[model samples]
Target: MGVERYNDLFITEKQKIFISDFNNNVKYFPDNVHFTLAGEISSDPGNLGSGGGWHRDSPYTNQFKTIIYLTDVGENNGPFQYIRGSHKKSGYKLINKVLKEYDYGENRFSDDEILSIVNNIDGFKISTITGKAGDLILVNTRGLHRGAPLTEGTRKAVTTYSFRNKIPNKFYKT
Candidate 1:
């Protein structure tokens, strides 16, 4: 994380707000994980439009993410969408069972489809996560989420990942 990275984000006072928290949270990870990448989605006309579908993070061990919204988000502005408490329900056994041969995001399903899988689980709630300019969302790695279309202005955000103490064997090349 450098000053230039903060400059690229269009939020007000994003550097002071996010950096302070980022520095503190960095201590939580074990030696295997390093804070990597600080940038935004480069897709042109870049609001990932509606019904973007459900997906996971990296395919190896479950991952965690911290998202800082540099702008206000609402239903029309493509608010970050996620299911609360979904992370606690997922585990390596279930991940391996469903993805025996397929990779993450490869054999993806629709939100409705995925919701059906866990609909019966207690305390499930899907939402269009709205937040203020400096609000942060802490996400579990295997957490199910996706981009919803923005009806208005661009939704600016910065996302970074966290991993377990040991990098997965498959993350290495042959």
Candidate 2:
């Protein structure tokens, strides 16, 4: 089922256009990619599911992700939220330090910890993205972001993860 969805996304014209546009603007190719379909309908508001807590996809590497909403997302539903401009080196360092200190073994930051970190960062802005089906969001997952908890209704989406090794290889151009 997952593979089928991924293949569908790969062949879709809309997705192709998105990827092409993204590739044109970014330095690295969106290679080593994988996708997942999240159909979350959590009744517990506090439960930070796999992608629900404030966390980075990788601690020390650069990675990107594209999230396409399959269902209409509202504030009450699980909207994709991000701390704007948090992908910079300083922001990354700050977040990494906080996560290391509060490392709970799960690689996810608690709400209090996330809030505290946000408070410490000057001019930090949290953006809640609510969109209709087919809306696409490109994000650097090395920043502070999360899937906001759902108060009601289901939130379905497909997220593609693309990662590249930071170390330069002598044989291949990164």
Candidate 3:
């Protein structure tokens, strides 16, 4: 829907106001950039059987995402864990290398390995973003990120992404 509708879904007024500004900044994204969709992430329908663990967004250039909480978050409930500014240096290629090396033959990197990669990086800073209903996290899509496990009350949040215009994928992979 619209930002105004999303404003009401948030738990606080200040958050609503801040999101409004966020929307503006998104609208002004340079023509060279393409804005991605913004929406909610809840353990209700879409997340019914999924446990989004620590992982970064699809490795792509000129892409970014913003996450807004509509519910309280804590250690019990899955909260977002991220590596601050990781987007500034590493990208999809580098991240894959780190994962491949750390995961061995697992194909997927474990949480510890992910954190280690971020921490060991030259300018890396890892953080777990926990906040009340109104907190928001803006992430560089190229940055590493993932949802924490939900152990308590349902977790509700909205996410939006922006990206540079590029040709759509024409091939399908099985």
Candidate 4:
């Protein structure tokens, strides 16, 4: 198959359009990634807050990612969770607080630290997205988000990481 055909197999029209528009006219490369089988990450997926904890992809830059669920995802199967309005709310207050505790490259946050900031902002609700296989999820990775810890069963997903400018590759454990 041709290169465009290969991309067509994974990049939906909406995904292409959104990524292009979301990052303005900047260039982007879509990476179709399949990973994390059952028992691949950890025998106990919910191993404390070590793996699937709350974080922002690039706390100081714009980041976009699209995910497709390859398996049924319930609360216990590691649903994707987002702190609504986090992409735009809290402003420097959030960044300042996080930077003081963590460097820009390491942007993971503890539950108490994240909650303490968002709680002050009105309309910032936590949205846990649980869906069936083949569901498409678009996320602003610069916002505070995470995959809920799995307690039973397994969760598998394919992700497309989009970037405006070329940068070093980074991957987060599911």
Per-residue C-alpha lDDT of model 4 across residues 2-115, encoded as one tens digit per residue: 123344545457655664464454333343222221212222844542136888877776566666676788877778898866766455455556446555455788888767
lDDT of 3 by residue, 1-174 (tens): 234343444335665456445644664354332222334444453342112555545443435556777678876566787666655533444555665644322323466877667755655655768888767886654565667655556676666444445423531121
Stretches > 4 Å off in candidate 3: 1-17, 23-28, 31-51, 90-108, 115-119, 122-125, 165-174
Better of 1 and 2 by lDDT: 2
User: Which scores greater on TM-score, model 2 or model 3?
Assistant: 2
Predicted candidate 2 versus true structure: per-residue lDDT over 129-165, tens digit per residue: 9999888888887677898877777777777655453
lDDT of 1 by residue, 98-155 (tens): 4455344443556555555455554555667898877877666466677666667766
The Cα local distance difference test for each model comes to: 0.56, 0.67, 0.55, 0.62
**For candidate 2, which ten residues in a row score worst on lDDT?**
165-174
Query: Which residue pairs overlap in candidate 4's backbone?
Result: none
My TM-score estimates for the predictions, one after another, are: 0.60, 0.75, 0.60, 0.67
Ranking 1 against 3 by lDDT, winner: 1
Q: Which is superior by TM-score, 3 or 4?
A: 4
Report lDDT (Cα) of residue 161, candidate 1: 47
On TM-score, the stronger of 1 and 4 is: 4
TM-score of 1: 0.60
lDDT of 4: 0.62
